[model samples]
Target: MYVAAKGGEKAIANAHRFLAEKRRGNPQLPEMSVEQIREQLGLAVDRVMAEGSLYDRNLAALAVKQAQGDLVEAAFLLRAYRTTLPRFSPSPVVDTGSMRVLRRISAAYKDLPGGQVLGPTYDYSHRLLDFSLMEPEAFAANVVYLVDKMIALPSRIPRLTEIVGSDDLVETPQEEPDQDPPVPDITEEPLEFPASRSARLQALARGDEGFLLGLAYSAQRGFGFQGHPFVGEIRMGYVPVEVELPGEDVKVRIGSILVTECTMLSRAEETGGCPFGFVQGYGLVFGANERKAMAMALVDRALRSRELGEEVRYPAQDEEYVLRHCDNVESSGFVQHLKLPHYVDFQAELVHVRRRDVKKSQGADDQGPSSVGSAGEG
Candidate 1:
């Protein structure tokens, strides 16, 4: 048994070596670099950053490569790395209205103050794969030249919600009171039942994409409120981050980061003194993960059951249900842990079952033949 155990340890070491070799398959071909992944496979890096709750592109790319292109695993690796970093003061609240817009679109209105700018989207593209990507140089050259020739987008674009508010068609966001309420940080505190909006948003922001997408779909398909929702606006751009130093009234610009923001409008019920109108659900995440933002917006709206005076019958409407199960790291770890050795537990169960069976057999044998014959006669 000792020899077998030693052999198993050696086998595990050799398996890791084999995996490393396979990850770098061809020596003749150029080795895949972190820069290449960041530049070319940008969407994957964006997902890793969003789900990992960290916004470093280079680190996300490196994690992607290390995970052998498994996006969830890459996100897990990035999240693990994030836990080791020193904490700093939280950045000032982002002003999405002042974002330097690259891509902006509104489904609610065709013609708004700012024209819809479709930037770097695959929405209108044909689904067919282009084999020409095999020749990288030509494709890279054309893309670079096209980008160089393109005009810079306007620094500020009017949001669709702003336009809609002019006609008083939607309820505007409530202004802050004299005393700002304390916003709960889910990362620092253990999640409890009846989460605050801040905590809910934080949970949804880092949730697994597929899981959120599924819940969003289920909500839309009449499982939840089933209110008609329209994408009021979807914008992708870079927003400047600012941080206020200790004992200072002034704020300093940290850096800029690319983000995608979605605003969804849903049907609102008429209440006392308030006319029937539209309510908003908002979502924002690092990088250009539009689908995640959109799904998040939908789920966010669904989760407003109590505030919106809607029935909380569906899974999406339940705060504890969604927030508790949305984390990919927690779910994946528990599921994968099942593969660990269970021999001792199984052996214990085996012994108990055998003992129970022997007792039952002895009880049957102790029954007399006369008792068996009388039973048969009856």
Candidate 2:
């Protein structure tokens, strides 16, 4: 029988109190508001929401502030809070083609339909910091005025994949009656391999950005797939969210969300029982996370090696390995749990080590002090 230890409860409580005090820091300065975090540190909020699998911006911001800027901890907090809420019916599929185009670009062609709309980005900025931004005068005018002269894009922009598919340049999955399978939700059911493409995509969407980025880089550098894939298109904007009323047979647009999407084009193997044509990988993420979206697209393609009849020769191609370790919360918990007390197991290990050392010492003593001295020296 296991007995519960007593008398550490006060210490734990005091430790928590100390943590809260430390998190506040510098009482003279005004406390940061949740709204400020929501508007200013939006990227961090977006990451927390994406990884937590929750879509509430205000709650995500609150989590970030409560966790004191530790994004993973914020995600953990948000995820824990998410479990208490009741889940209603799933939302209908989002249509990216009808997204309000704030930013769109393509690497396949010099210019394409809808043109290259470079929205808020640091891509062209010099790495050196501009001290002017620190001045009070720098906040004089909002940056939105700079783009006021640019013409607005149409309501619906054509996807590059659709164009390529129509021209027979890329292998488009047919939507035949038998081929159209229901998408599995990774959050609802336990993941198993060989996982369906939809399940893998869902897992990837909620995966750690840093882990996915590293894996995607490795794949691009000849670890899984050879040669670089082209960014067919990358678009970021606001997309409308809709949900069908239960038993009403009608859908309603309740809100809109900012999202980033990418499509990567790669050479497909002909042995997959299809004609030689380019294949595409798709990625969509909440918020304007272009790097994560691009990385996801690349890794998504690498994970399709088995379906495309390519050899699974690298880590990126292994679905089970990728999906299982992709969740940062799970990985962090397993790794950090080692800090907890393990007195009994550690004591046993220590006893075994001491006995082995004593046995070695006795053997050395049998061989005289000379051997003992040599053993001690070496």
Candidate 3:
């Protein structure tokens, strides 16, 4: 049966007002502030910022609150806001080597030059929840000491990749001065096939964390992946951003942003029948999102199957599939759109099903009970 649509304008307005009421919940409880979400629910904000491809923590938190903690929807809101903002000059390449290191770890080497500074991480913590956090105690002075130590730490730490660079064990692609083309901005153009390494990296940087995480895990489980990959290094900290304005020769520091960087080393066949060695895959993302950074790194390495002369037979290894579907906003929009009114489409499908059943019934009646027994006997 087909249903008629009614109460178009007023019904929508009433629905919106009802939604507001539901979102508010009990009026007795104090409403949560955006700042509270930004500071307290920082990890959620970080995920939103990373996937949304925007770096504003406050706005990301606001989106989270508005979306009722639905992270994908929050990311969608932030991305929509990003489109309305005016384009400014691109920032200079960030120097992670000079980062004020907060947390740094190396799975490849235990004793490196930096001596594995475990600044702030949940890796060592027990999984048990501390109910005391429901009413947290006052902050202690050790936290202050930790912050001071982070600030006073030497400006530049030697990069692990740099140490191995001279050895030529990893396939490091170097940029030729005045010879290499500028990296394509994935945001400014549609993603085309046979994408450049830079373009793939750009797309993966903002891809959905859960999607990347799953694909990365699949790669580790022998799906279009070869050998075990080691985390060369993972670092999380604030790196200063600088930009040179138009018609100005000097560059000014535009403040710092918290970022996580991961470098993964996977086995690679050497060129010209040389000995086997490791190739690096790099991942960097906004805010302290180590999981996303690591996942991105794994996916990055998997996507390099073609360049590495490896078999490309899995979804994780397919650049077009990964890049096209990893976008949470686009995926969410398409999937969620099914919730919209499909009255006409449903009616058409219903009519087709009824007609099919009627034809089957008529055919059965024409054969009758005698025909059914004769066919069975035959």
lDDT for each residue of candidate 2 in 114-200, tens digit (9 for 90 to 100): 788888888899999776677736665543476668686798998786665355667664655865567787777989899998898
TM-score of each: 0.87, 0.89, 0.89
Model 2 residue 4 lDDT score: 29
lDDT of 1 at 215: 93
Ranking by TM-score: 3, 2, 1
Ranking by lDDT: 3, 1, 2
- Judge candidate 2 against the unseen true structure and give its global Cα lDDT, from 0 to 1: 0.85
| Candidate 1: clashing pairs of residues | none
Candidate 3 structure quality by residue, lDDT tens digits, 297-367: 99999998888787789999999999999998888877777777888999999999999999999999999
* Model 2 stretches astray by more than 4 angstroms: 1-7, 141-150, 165-168, 176-180, 269-274, 355-378
lDDT for position 355 in model 2: 100
What range of 10 consecutive residues in model 3 has the weakest lDDT sum? 138-147
The lDDT values for all models are: 0.85, 0.85, 0.86
Task: List model 1 lDDT by residue over 111-187, tens digit each.
Answer: 86778888889999999998779897877777654566767766667666666654556867667799877888776
Error of 3 at 239 (Å): 1.0
- Deviating ranges (above 4 Å) for candidate 1: 1-9, 141-144, 166-168, 269-276, 348-378
Between the candidate structures 1 and 2, which one is better when assessed by TM-score?
Answer: 2
